[model samples]
Target: MGGKQGPQHPRTPRRRFDIMSRYWTFLLVLVRVILPLKAEETSACPADCACLEPQHHILCSNASLTSVPSILAEGTLELRLDYNNLTSLDTGAFLGLSQLSALHLSYCGLRNIQPGTFEDLHSLEYLHLDNNLLESLEEGTFRNLSRLLYLHLENNKLTFLGPDVFQPMDKLSALYLSHNLLTELSNQTFNDLPQLRWLYLNNNLLSNISIKAFAGPRRLRKLSLEANNLTSVPRALRQASSLQSLRLSSNPIRQLGSFGRKLRSLTELYLDELGLQEVSSTSFAGMRRLRTLSLRGNQLEILSLPLLGAQTELLLSRNPWRCDCRLLWLYVHLQVMKSKVSQGEALCSTPTALAGQRLLNVELQKLTCPAFGSHLTTAAPYKVPTYSATTAKRTPPQVMETPKTTTRTTIVSLATKATQPPPVQHPVPASNAVPERWDPCLAELISKVAVRPKGEGALMVTWSTIGEHDQVEVRYSTGEAVQVLWVTGELAEVELNQLHMDTDYKVCIIPLSKHVAQCTNPNPTQCAMSHTSGWGGHIQPVHMQPTPSHSALGTGVAVAVLILVLVALVLAGAYKLRSRQAGFQRHFDEDGFESERYNPDPYKLDGVYESNEEDRKIFVTAASQWSTEDEDKLDCRLATSPTVLSTPRYVTL
Candidate 1:
């Protein structure tokens, strides 16, 4: 039940009838689980497969059918051998689909599967080997998929998945290895998937991911790694505290490693098209439940980053922004969150008479800069990443040598990053790389508490405050009362209520401003009490859970099998976290069957990039090329290559 699909612009017809009413209500749940048998000679329907009777499915897509026609009528239930060329699947390849439940071997040039080729599909549950040419997968190739719940090995050529390669997929919950060529992921590689909640290793070539490869998903909400080469921010995802969407767009991630101030159940983050030039006002420190951030095509100029998480909503379109005075405080914060803090129109590209205006329509007194010799430099303060799994110590990645002429910026024929492509420069890893202080808390730096369990004994404490913090104290003790609630102004969620039911308590969150600080550590604390206390930062202990009754018969069948596995994981993580989509980087722009030498990353780059354009649909329309005859065909190809363009360069992870 991993839903939240998003990305299909709203030209509205009820948003295209709500995506065809969610694909006809998930095809009437595969036509009520297929079954109408009893029709003669192997249910006759194989020549160029299209069997539709009682819709037991089977649309042998682009039928170059390399054999699977195996007299299949055990009520065949959905099998669409996509764009076929079936390289190899062999071994009983559906020897009578035991009621196959959706299986689309996508764009199949399928390069070998052969391991009990889907052990007689015991009612398989949506398994699409996306645009295949799989590289390696054995652990019994999803050994009889335990009611597999969506597992698409996106555009494969899977590099190496080995370790328990998704072993007995314990009810796999959406695991798409996006545009694969997976370079690494071993230790408990997606460990015994306990309903892995949507983990699409986006456009892979992943540089060794495995701080215990998500030591076995415990409802990992969404982790995309958009175009990987991650440089830090993976202290094993601090054991995924039920992580809630983290995409890391076009990675080459350098800094902002403030490991998102310990994820606190992050709310959709995707540092867009990474090539970011500057943005650290504690680059989203402790993401106070960040709500959709994506600095679109980056190279951001003068963006003193601080659209803090408390209510963040930005995409910032194709960034190359600039309007100076350090971006006039985001053009006066976009005139106080105008248009709820933008989705596009962040244009500007520097003073060639304000190149293309609209960094929030310039003029904050013409956002000045240039006090002297200024090709606009001064962007230093950012050494984020704070890795700590108990006393951090992650060495290697101390390249800090910028200030070398403010780190290379040789744009010749104006931007578009000289025809992008070459972001494999990892940098940012010498763990605990500080540099971010000053917190008289005017919001955007402190006070974040995240509890959950809102039933028996109650608790839903979701906070985030810092200054003028008039109220908000919440304290759980298990050994007593609601402890304390208070909560006022800028109220960031609260629910406390009584206590001690299935007791697991130990919560805390202070934020009451009157400049009271006196809890100077001495260990033990559910966030100290006698009220006002002397505080001394850096304490982190996190681990922020539930259930019930004095029963008989051995904890009442383990609490009725843990309340029917927590009511099927709270109804599939609360209907996909209440229908997620704080613009989840539009899941790399909703694939839309992207294949054609899979991802020919194009943004009209030339100077050097080798493509990775998010899910390159090669500019289908920016109004068919943003005017001036595409800038005079890119200034006649930079005046027939007059050289020296340079830009994308980073390397050091």
Candidate 2:
């Protein structure tokens, strides 16, 4: 048995070999991995600081340090030295931090930043110098930071900024310069920043802004000029055709001037607390796409109702609104808007009947006032729908322009069947009010209009009715109020007298449509009918006011109609000729796409390449990974500490 190997003895060598191999692996990990990590932590990070791994983001906030530490890692991407005592920055202070992408130096009592301080930070994107005592930045202070995006200089003591101080940061987007002491904004102040989107100049002492102050940043979206000394809409804003949200509140402005056509893209406009009174006829003339108009805390008694278009999120709180017949249109508008509103301070500070009550709480017919002037344009008493006792709670939803000279929201007349319409009531007319040109009232109604002399001052008007109706109303706006003359028989005609020789009117006939039940039905399929009680289409209304020489006027109109037909034919021929020539000239596109001339993909993307800035993560495809690190995951979250705001004069500090 000793000479021959037993079953247990044969496995001794193999088990010993396994134990030795495991021991060698443990020694290797301690020497190469664990020891090196400890050494690197001590050498790379400064004392009294926290260093995040992989990205090398150093957080030295609230450490009470007096100066910057010299031993910093070259691969550091972000450095937070906020809440320290770095009173000033010298030239080339961060010379070795070439890879730094974001530097937070806020609340450091920094009074000055010398030139060439950030000259080596080529990869810097966001720079925070807010909550400091920075009186002025030396010219070319940010010499080489070309990739900078967001710059925070708010809550500082900066009194002026050189025109080319930001010339190196062409890609900057959001700039916060609010709560500073800037008294004036010169030409080319923002000329070098074409990609700038959000600009904050609020809470400054800026009483003057040059015509070219906002000239360069054509794509600027959000601009805040609130609490500044500006008294009017800056003309420099005219160049910003892509401007969307503009804040000009609390500026002591008393009047609103012309908003040129270039501001048509403005969506949210804040004119609150301006104590405004006089508004030009064309104050909001070109803002066709305006969605939000806040007139809070303004000293105004009336505003043109036509200014309120569809889908508008209007804010009219804290204002003295006159809720009368002229303003009844607004009450109807609010009802239609339903829940897409935030009128926090919306209350009536007007006529004794509606005083101190919410506008929505008042009844529609109770909002009565005097006649409307011809200077305005808006809607009149539209077709009123009577709800059943339970229908008010069950009303589902509801969802037009009248004449320009006389604005009246009236619809088509249905030919009378049995009963005559009720007599006209003397109330406020929508003489100055009209719906938008594309409003449902006129767009669906005016197929034919007939008018002739019925008496010395009266004219007989007739229109095509929609359906047989027990009651029909001849809706016309030729007097102080929207005149509703009842037609007795099947003919849709009524003679309306000219109370004054005013040049304005449109024949809009509103038929008493049937009751449209808008209740919450358990079966949605059975209640598929629309929640509306009127017609909607695209058409033009007739305006037939007789001239002094009735005979010659008829002949001239015939000649004018013939000329218009000839011009239309000529224009069509020219367009066809030009299109054929352009098609022959087209061969290929920049994208190497081939298609029939004048024809492309439905999205028009077959022949063009647009890397839209709004598209997130949209890019061209790549075959190889040049670098392992993805910048999209970079830690760019800003600190959420309480920002220092210069309190308004009314509040006790």
Candidate 3:
């Protein structure tokens, strides 16, 4: 029964939606048989068979075909059509070649390719179009090659790429678009290729990149955009979230600002040969994860804020990094991190303080204040000698010797200075002897003194308007009176000799009536008196010489002659000393005496000398005279040195 049923009817085959089934039966099978596409010898293939396939390669070497062989179609997986005379490729030229895996069209005369030229090469993996006259690519040109993994489009005149020219090759892994004229890239140009890893875009004219242009293919690891004119790190690279290594060694990035934020995933960042001077904070904020950072052959002055990140290895040699206080932090931190990091190259940039010093070997102590102790000492504020009453009046410093005495009054009134005693509180009426409220009585007296500039002797005094009666009296003294020469509102000077210099003046109050000038509120008289008389040095009246009697004149004349002779001797001695000192100076000036051996001899003293030169002259002159005297006459001769040879001495000149 089964045999009878099967004999008379034939059944139709069901449709297949499987891409492989449809493509294979409709395209591959027909292309393999009817096209008779095979080549045996590169030069002797049948006109119908594209070329005889020898070892599965249809080698149409040096083929003079102006167009591709129209009827040649087969399952030939590798096609070598090098040295061809083809100027252009038709979209459907290889329409039925489903098994073509490697296609080499190098050194061909191909000038242009239609949009769908290789759209039917579904199984093609490696396509080489190098050494061709191709200018550029149009969108959808390789639309059907979804499994293409290697695309070589180098050595061509491609100035730029159309936005979606490579959009169809979703599985492409390696691309060779180097040696082109691309200047910039658009965002999403590489968006869908999930399998791309190695991109060689070097040796091109790329200058900039869109921030999101590399936002695809999480596996993209090594990218080389070197040998291009880049003034900055590609913006697309900053957002290249999955990049592991980047090569931007040769560029014109003069400043490293936010430069490291881009390569968060970068293990190695090559920044060598860049023209950089300073690196700021954001340059390494994102590179806290970096393992190796190289900054060789750059123009850097110091390792500043940017280098304060955690890197396993850092290279900063061959750069001119100036080590200074500004670099103190980096200098010290580098040392502590040396043993922790590995394979790092750190070197010095200065040959003085930092000479031959590895950054890792320089400790913070070496840069501390102690290293420049002398400089610090010299720079510190110094203590200078200030003139105070206590200092100015100390033993009334030895007088400077001058030449002549004019009058007896000119003789300085000398006194044995006694140490002062602490102040004592006096009774109120006695203390009030010096009034506090501007002293109307005293003010009138000051007016009188102010009008007396024509008089030979005139005095004026002022006192502060505050303090208790006792404190006020003690504070104000005739000795502290400052004289106003021209009657200006402010006092000009304090004449210490105007009042008793060594006197302790006290006080008494007989009300305002005692003042030389009358007061508005006349109460009792008030006046000051000395607790001790002659408390200060005495003041002799200016007694211009008294007419000398005959006897006195004779005595005076003899004394004057003796004084003149002594002066002559002193002048001679001084001349001799000056000659000796001048001779010494000449020897010194002529280099006859070693300067180090010519230190001052403190034992050879010249009293009250004005300067080192004058002191030397006096010492030499006096010493020569003394050296000639006998021991018995030494005292008298020595005494003569200060008196006979001595210049005039004054207490206050």
Candidate 4:
């Protein structure tokens, strides 16, 4: 019974092993044959290209093929065919590539493409055809590519594009056509691209554009037209209501016209290198939202302050700005908004006296109006409104003629004509006779006071005077103590040696009259106290010493000596090495037996051993005619001795 049970168990195990072998054979056949056949049916890449599976992409760049390979992977998302020799594209060239999203055909020598060539690629979103030889595009060239978002046609020979070339790409967002031969843009060139945001047309030969050329693309944000032959600001830009940045540099535009009321959304306007001689005040009135305005590299001699917005960043460098009275208001406005103007780029380029001076460094007194000739007191009556302390919040005063009884009214009106000010008037005494008293008006004639650092805890204070004054007084405080100094001119230098370094100081200025000593009285009726200047000047005192000229000169001399010594050592070492080489060559030439034993090639010895008598005579004649300098040049070529042979040599003559 035990033997029978053992045999049955062994037979059962053998039966199970047979069934498992058959199952493993079926699985191997499915993996090796059925799965590959199914893959081949789904997608097949061309032999000349590489396919990235799972995410189908074909890479066939620089393959040097004449035509687009037809056997591309079936659901290919991207196909790279750059650097190929494809001269033209047929309608059915991409018949099976309907799933392609991006196509790269740059530098492919593509000169022409038939209409409806890309009709099969309905899902294509990006097309790169730059660096090709295409001269023109047909109206329906991109007929069915409605989903295309970006079209790159830069560096092509495209002289013109059909009006409806981009009509089918309704969803296109960006179109790059730079470095082309386009001469003009017609009205309907980009009519159907409503969603276009960026249009780059730089580095073209564009000289003209239809007035309605940019009427479309209402949602466009940026437009670049640099390096074109435009003679004036394009009137077509008025239709781009949503454009934020517009660059028109490197053009020959001589004058700027009003931007119209359409470009209200523009934030950046670049008109640099346009040869602009003048700009109308209304040229930028419509761009109230503009943040940056660049006028660099132009011929402008003057600019108006009203043309710029308050918060605009102005770039006016490299322009021939004439610094005169006409620009006084602009200089004052720039001073008030100094933080918004670039000091290094704000330079004057005209008027020989003020040329090369920074606009920020120009003093207010130096910007006097030459047209208003003579002093303000002698000029025509320039009305200046005066405010009373009690009626300061009231409306502005009206001009009125003075009565015959008041001689003081005539003098006050004449003085007020010259200055635009908060004038203060004094009551006249009834005595009508000329009193021997200093005029109180001298105290109110001071205009502006400026303070500059002079190192070593010193300050240089300069003020402009409008009327006669005896002296100028300066009062300063260091938060602990107050100090006063009296100076004699429109300019003064004060040394605060007592103040500590790096301490903040508050300073003010006042013009003093000759009656200042008498005005010190507690109840002086004839003398009045003058208005004190505000604390506009805050300075941090710094201690600095003058650089020693002798130390700098000594350093320069030491550097010169060291450089000379280094150059001399280099020349000396080179000379010694050359001399040693020449000595070794001379020594080798003098050893006759050694030269003959080592030098197997005698022709290398500068023709010392000629193969025939004719050659030997030619060499000797050339050597005898050589000049001394030419002979020295041949020292490395020629041996020292002419006959240094151990064995006798024979010529072929």
Candidate 5:
């Protein structure tokens, strides 16, 4: 009750009036508590424009505002101060903007972001300060923005940036610092940004980088350093194992080995227009997981076999190459690897011998090595014949000194000589008639064939020449093919068995113009027709045809012993004859062998037995004197000999 029944019936009206007043007061308090009070929008500006949308938001973009308006408060959650002529952001300008979440200062003439410029914006999550004249960043400038997640500093004139620019932004995920003048980065700069994911450092003047410049933030997945002045890819970036794409196409690194080790994890590599030569096997060895490699527009002489790794598509166009046997080997190897060699214009770079030759045009199987001299050394594991005086007499088509003294006799088989077929003379094409041609058979034959002598006085020719050859030039592949024999005719019978055995070779008669007249038909189609005795003044059948020396083992031993005995006998005969002559001449005085005489005939008297007393005296005196002894006794000389025998003068006197 109403004040205990309204202070009695008489004062009831007064009590009721007082209670109503109290109720009205209570209602007034309730109204003050529940009523919606509006926050002040920026009313200091023009009436037609909306500067501050709410108590927490303000968009002053292109607002003709020179500096920050004073209406902003600590509760502001977003601000757009872009496109302004402001050259610098003053510290404490946003002092009370603690709730600011998005701050866009893009295209502002912000030459510098002073320390504590954004210190009050603790709730800031997105910051866009792009298109500014910022040359440097002060440390701890953004220390208060702990919740900042996205930071864009692109299109700035920043030459060097401090590591602590983003130090407070622990939850930052994307940081774009592109289009800057940064040359290098300091290690541990990115260590604090553990949750950083996307980092764009492209379009900067970065030339070199420290090893651990980007060491931290293992959770970072995407990093781009493209369009910088990086001559070579940094080894530190290879530690970014999660990296998927790397573009190093426009750098000056030439050798493939320089980057092979660092790019083992890269799946896509762009190396276009880089200089390269013969890439060694170790270059691409570690990049086993690599799938795409771009090697377009490089200086390569040959595509090496070892360069072709498994499951790789090689792009080797626009390069120089030496299309020879080695290239042929490479071509065959590539085909076996099943990796397509792209860029078809990759022809032989040799403009002279291999001009306009496409790699596809050459038949690898038909590729023949150029003619190498027989005297050349080879590393192949086969015993090739070596030239010597004794081995020279066995080879046919004798070519050596004294062409006229040596003879070549051609004896035709009396019966086959009449029935032999004429030599087939096919017209060879001008192109094919060149010194060299692309013929597979010739190549195979040269690689697999060997030549040697078969028997005494017989030259054996064995070869597998499947392809057409105008005339096979058969010479002692290794030794001199000439024979020194005593046969006064166009042909001579020499010995054979000089060639290496179990070897294939192509053998045909080469004309000997110096020793014989030119025959109408020198070599016939078949070997039998050409080898008929001495058809073309070659040699006798027994000598021209290779007859393997068929000596039994015992016979060979006996022959060797006979040769030794013959040599011994000749030496003994010469010795005995010399001894007998010496003995017989010794009896004759003047005619005998002269011994050095002490006294010559002219020095002695003819008839008288001359006394050599004076000579003997001089001889004894000279023999008794020694150089040192004489010098020591220089003062003593007193001995003389008398008449009969030069007796001791001192004793007989």
Candidate 6:
């Protein structure tokens, strides 16, 4: 068999096995030592930076590092390089940080970003570049950051943004571009960001925006354009159906037209510090859901009641409201809803006497119009005596009408007498006697009388005649003196001045006949007076009331009282509820067995129990004979006794 040992494999297989073992040992050593050492060196933090290993957060804030460090861990999730001196972001600045979700480069002195600077940040969700010197961003700079949700570029010097600048960031929700130098926004500036919800463009030099600028973000909820140079409300805003808040403060808008019925979802609106002088009644017609409306610091003189909603929170401070008759409508409306208006801030600015007076303090009675009494009469002419300004006594004067006709009649008689022979005037035939003609004296009745306020201390009395008359006279008396004004038109007006502000006056319209009645004639006929039913005859009294003031005060007081009563009732109810609860708790405590059992008592040795005489004797005897054996026996007896075992009585000596 030894001979057949097969030419002696001579331990060749064993030698190969040994050689393989050594090779494996070397490979193992390389894997366990050399590879780990390399990994450790690669994972080391950059200079002047702090790295959190467990959280994989690298913070290099306030570091003088001129550029982004390349020694970040592969698993870094957040990188904060704020307050650094980074001038520009190269194409592959964040090349390997795939797991990074938040990148903050705020106040980094960053001037520009290359086209592909953020190409490798596929997992980034938040990017903050605020307080930088970046004038503009190259197109496609954030092309690879599709998952980015927030981008803050505030306090930058960006003058413009190219079309489709944020096209690749479809998931972006909030974009803040405040405090920038942007002059305008193109239609396609924010294209393709369908998920965008909040966009802030405040404090920019933006004077114009394309009508379709906000068309790309269909889900937008809030948009702020405050502190811009916009002269009016942008037409672009009506397209956002889901918008909830809009801010246009500190603009140059002079007026506000109706916000088309489409903005039904709008809740908050700010128009403060603008040059607004007028607001259409329908401006907020369809904004039913609006809750907050601010109009502080504007040039508004009056606000219509329909412009404000009942549930809306309004801010109307610093506006110049004229407290006059013209503003009576607003005043009454405010008085009706005094609780809704801001009392201290709603002040008047005109009518020197009312300047600086609060709208709530304005006297509504001070705004008044004259009252008029009208009567129509065609009565016969009666003696209308003329009175002096100083005397209330009246002096009668001769009544004359158609004096020219009388003069013409005398001239005709003289001519006839001169042409005919005087001796031929034998007894005048009865048939030749001249027939008396009716005079034109019936058209002297005033059909209508209208009185209106002329100024602060005057009244304008206007009247219309029912028929044609030669002359119409207006006699008015303020109880002290009577004045007559003769007017010669179908429609006549007399402005009575120097009249007391709040006093009653009697005015009468008298019509005179055109025919004359001579007082020297021995059998002179009296001037006939027409007693027409529709003619104004008697003097009508008109009362001039003071401006409406105290009534509004009474209304305000009533409303305040009602509100106070409601508040007091609510407080009383709350107090009653609290007292009832306290009473119930007291009753429960008085009736509870736990309170009585736990109450301290001087008669008992321990507060837990009140023992009888037999029980006390038993406890004293047990305590006097207390021992280890007795305690065991007692425990055994206690375990066996029905009441002791079942009820577990607590004994106190």
Q: For every candidate structure, what is the RMSD over all alpha carbons to the true structure, in angstroms?
A: 36.9, 25.7, 40.0, 29.7, 37.8, 33.7
Model 1, 319-346: lDDT tens digits are 7775656676567657656777654568
Report the Cα lDDT for candidate 1. 0.62
TM-score, candidate 2, is 0.53
lDDT of each: 0.62, 0.66, 0.56, 0.69, 0.56, 0.68
* lDDT tens readout by residue for model 6, 1-653: 97888776978898999999999999998899888888886667999999888888999999899999977787899999999999998888888889999999999999988998888888999999999999988778888889999999999999999996887998999999999999999999976889999999999999999988988999999999999999878888877888999999998888785555467788899999998887765477556567778889999876763434445666778999766555655665556557778667668786555788887777777542210111111122234457878887767654446433232111123235455322211333343233232222222235456666566546677665542232444445555665545554434666666655555556554443212111111111211111111213253567686556977888889999999999999999999789867765775687785445443456666433565667544321221212222113342222222121112122121
- TM-score, cand. 5: 0.46
Ten residues in sequence with the least summed lDDT for candidate 2 = 644-653
Q: Write the per-residue lDDT of candidate 3 for residues 1-653, one digit (tens) a residue.
A: 99988955553233334655777688877776655533332434435335545556576767665777654446677777778777789879886778889887887867898888887788999998877767778888788889999988887878877778888778999888877788887876787777888887877888878877788766788787866778876667766667777777776776654552446566777788888877653365444346667788888766654223433356777777655445665665566466654343555565355665666666655553222111111111223334567657334233334434321111111131122221122232431132233343332212111111111222222332111111111112344431111111123221222444444432222111122122333222333333232423566656565565866988989999999999999999999899878867776777765553353555444422334555443322222222121222322232222221123121111
TM per candidate comes to 0.26, 0.53, 0.44, 0.53, 0.46, 0.52
Judging by TM-score, tell me the better candidate of 3 and 5.
5
Rank candidates by lDDT, best first: 4, 6, 2, 1, 5, 3
lDDT of 2: 0.66
Runs with alpha carbons beyond 4 Å of true place in candidate 5: 1-57, 73-76, 260-264, 273-281, 288-291, 296-653
Query: For each candidate, how many residue pairs have backbone atoms clashing (under 3 Å)?
Result: 15, 23, 20, 0, 19, 23
| Predicted structure 4, TM vs. truth | 0.53
In Å, residue 220's CA in model 4 sits off its true spot by: 1.1
Number of the predicted model whose lDDT against the real structure is largest: 4
Q: Flag regions of model 3 displaced more than 4 Å.
A: 1-55, 58-73, 82-87, 107-110, 131-133, 216-219, 259-263, 305-311, 323-347, 352-653
Residue 312 in candidate 6, Cα distance off native in Å = 1.2
Q: In candidate 2, what are the lDDT values of residues 263-312, reduced to their tens digit?
A: 76788999999998645423774464677888888887655543334456
Off by over 4 Å in 1: 1-93, 96-104, 108-119, 122-144, 147-150, 153-169, 177-193, 201-217, 225-245, 248-262, 265-269, 273-283, 287-301, 305-318, 321-464, 467-653
